[model samples]
Target: MSGIYIHVPFCLSKCYYCAFYSMPSLKRKDEYLESLRQEMVARKDYLHGMPVSTVYFGGGTPSLLTPEELKTILNLLHDHFPVEADAELTLEANPDTLSLEYLEALNAMGFNRLSIGIQSFFDDDLRYLGRRHDSRHARQCIDWARSAGFDNLSLDLIYGLPTSTADQWNRNLDLFFATGAPHLSAYALTLEPNSILTKRIAMGKAQPVEETAAVRDYGILCQRAAKEGFVHYEISNFCRPGFRSKHNSSYWFQTPYLGLGPAAHSFDGKERRWNAETLDGIRSEYEALTPENAYNEYVMLRLRTMWGLDLKYIRREMGDAFADHCERQAAPLVAQGRLSRTREFLYLTDPQMLFADGIAAALFY
Candidate 1:
């Protein structure tokens, strides 16, 4: 099954740590809508009639779009694409943009899933992260989502805040589980090079993320989520059984997907393409992956998930030399137990997955 991603590039304000392309002003929203529709029509055959199993409206703040606006986009998708009836349709939301009424409208429109950016349950953390919503609204939005009949709900939480403690991070996790959401995306607080957080730290106005504190936070997150019955399916994502994000999971397996709007990325079986990050109109750019680039990407993406990296598949798809390279490079880490090798696959062990990027790089050609 394939997927579709729509990038909404407008935001009320940028988060201190975010460097994603987003327009801070909504003055050109109508213009954006028209350009997005045109792009959709043009790319209708990009997937070549593949059954779309998931549709994600991710953004700057998709919830800011009115119910009618969302409906119009959905209508266009249904008209042009082979979107499955049971497709996992998701909208990424901000806690500040949600209300009971808004959530109810979204639910009624057949948007079956919601991913709310509730970065923290503590007001202090919210303030430090430059989030627009406070702690109360974060909890309230989840309750509203449930009350609105949303069963497939996901929440975003940021750990590794320099000002945070293990107990505080534990409390954030506790509050998240209490909400009964089926999925969670817990991310480490890495400062983007040119982001406000990075600048502040460089200017001595903010504390940097301490490695020891981050490790402790990661340990608590892994241990507690396991106890709570959440599966650490990907490096930064956890989900209960039957609730893994199908759209996101597709990217790992190299599934062809169509992405619309500015700053959106799309991938066919070989070439990956993206729209330039501009609000006026859509400008596309693409990269056709060479065999070596594709192999490196396959190694990078496959290793980040619970599925791990498979030697058999690699040997068949990328040939024996590449598979041998992978096996040889992975042997030392496997011996250290940072990675574990089963007969079929090499997996980044649970605790050692914190170094997933480094491990993947080590196996790269």
Candidate 2:
């Protein structure tokens, strides 16, 4: 149930909406790779020899790494950790970088899952987002992945673009489902501070995102995904049965995980830790999870998914007073149809998912 997350911080160019730490040039690739290996060796015992159930290489673009470099890293992990024989190893990829040959090699190297960042299958949206690949390239990449024998594939899509219309979003979803990928991670386009999109909006060069439009699009997505028989397992993720992301689910269930590389966070049941955002400060930042903090996170994380919170478990683990507080807070939401409860669990209604964070915060002790 535990996981490992490796953050690869290199990309060919910056996307307009990206706020993640990444360097544009691979001029320092060797240095970074060496540093990554060193970090892995140093943190080898962090999991206490727990059998890693999942290994996720998320990035700037993990596919940018050569097969040999990837092999070396995986070899190091195998050498140092008790990685499960059938671990769900995933690599986040950009379409432009994936070829049949490269994908075949990746499959041979133990990457069973591919999370391709397509963003949108529209050329206009791709250009607006500053993505390197076009619509055709994305389709070709999926074809190549299937040809290379990858069945557990995930596609990343961004909806709620300022110029996105309902028809356009539907077309995106239609094309996405046609690809037969088992998992989809659709996200709303947010204007994060200091991002290129945010700056453009500030300069009056780009229109600000319409909150109402985004909500409407989210509704469209939910309805469409349900019709397609995809499970809305998490607020932003839809997957076919038995295809939920094991690594991400570990986070929701509060299983211990060790995160490697800059800007990565980790939890070990009681304490939470994170590495610094910059390579120069790759050391750890530690915080002990107090009873209050843990209770807040337990509710927050559980509320983000379809699994919801187990009230009985909370009463047993977090005490009856906390459980009673939750019931009192939830009674109004349930009455208003924003929340729903069964004998054992409570969860947000689909429409209320957009307000999950706020609702969780409001219910916090």
Candidate 3:
């Protein structure tokens, strides 16, 4: 099954660590939405009648869109695409922008999933990250979403902030688990180049992230998630059974998908395309996947998930020689406890998951 992604590039305020394309003002909201609709209509045939399994509204704060604006876009999608009856439609929201009434309206408009950006539940941490929502707002938003009948809720948390301590990080996780959210996406804080946080660190105005502390926090997250019966599905994502983000899984499994709006990316199984990070409309850059590129991506993406790499499928799709080479390369790593293999799949061991990208790179053809 394929998927569709819509990027909303307007935010009330910019986070210090964010690198995604977005503006703090909604000056061009109408024009951007119109262009998004046009882009969808123009790219309707891109998926070639494949039933769209998921529709994800990601962004610079999707909750900022009014109900009418959101509904208009959803209606356009329904009219133009073959969206599945039970498609996993998701919207990324910020706690500060969501209201009980607004969330209920979103539910009525066919959004079955809500991923809220609650980076931290501590006021200090929130301020340090330059997030608009305070701890109380975050908790209230979750309670309101539950009241609004959103069962498939996901919460995003960022750990390893410069001022965060181990106890504080644990408290954050405890609070997160108490919310009863079925899905969680936790990421370690990293300063992106040219971002406010990075600039501050360079100027010695803010402390840089400590690698040891970040690693410890990641370990804590994995252990807590396992104890809580959440599957560490992706390196950075944990979910209750049957609650994985299907749209995100499509990308990892190399399924074809189309992305609309600014700074969105799409993959067509063999080629990859992405729009420029500009509100000037959907100008895109495309690349035809080479054999090496496909092989590297196949290993890289699958290795990052719990599903692991399917050796049999790889052999059939990529060739027996390539599959054999992978197994041969993995033999040593498996012995070193960095990787483990079942009868037909190979995956990174829990302790070595932090090195997944490097491990995948080492096994690249």
Worst 10 residues of 2 by lDDT: 275-284
lDDT string, candidate 2, 1-365, tens digits: 58999998889999989999888878877887887888888888888888899999998888999999999989988998899999999999999888999999999988999999999999988987889999998999999999898899999999888778999999999999999999999988987888998888888987878888879889999999999999998889999998999999999999899988888898888899998877774688999998888889999999989988899999999998889988889889888888888988999767678778988887788
TM-score of each: 0.98, 0.98, 0.97
* Model 2 spans > 4 angstroms off: none
Encode model 3's per-residue lDDT on 154-263: one tens digit a residue: 99999888788999999999999999999999988887888999998888987887878878899999999999999998989999998999989888988899999999
Candidate 3: stretches off by over 4 Å: none
TM-score of 2: 0.98
lDDT of 1 by residue, 1-365 (tens): 68999999888998888988887778888998999889988889999999999999998899989999999999999999999999999999999889999999999999999999999999888888889999988888999999999999999999999778999999899899998999999888888889999998899988887877777888899999999999999989999999999999999999999999998999989899988888766799999998789889998998899899989999999999899999999899888888889997998757677888999999998
| Candidate 2 Cα lDDT to native | 0.90
- Clashing pairs for model 2 are none
RMSD of each: 1.0, 1.1, 1.1
Off by over 4 Å in 1: none
Residue 203 in model 2: shift from native, Å?
1.3
Lowest-sum lDDT 10-residue window in model 1: 347-356
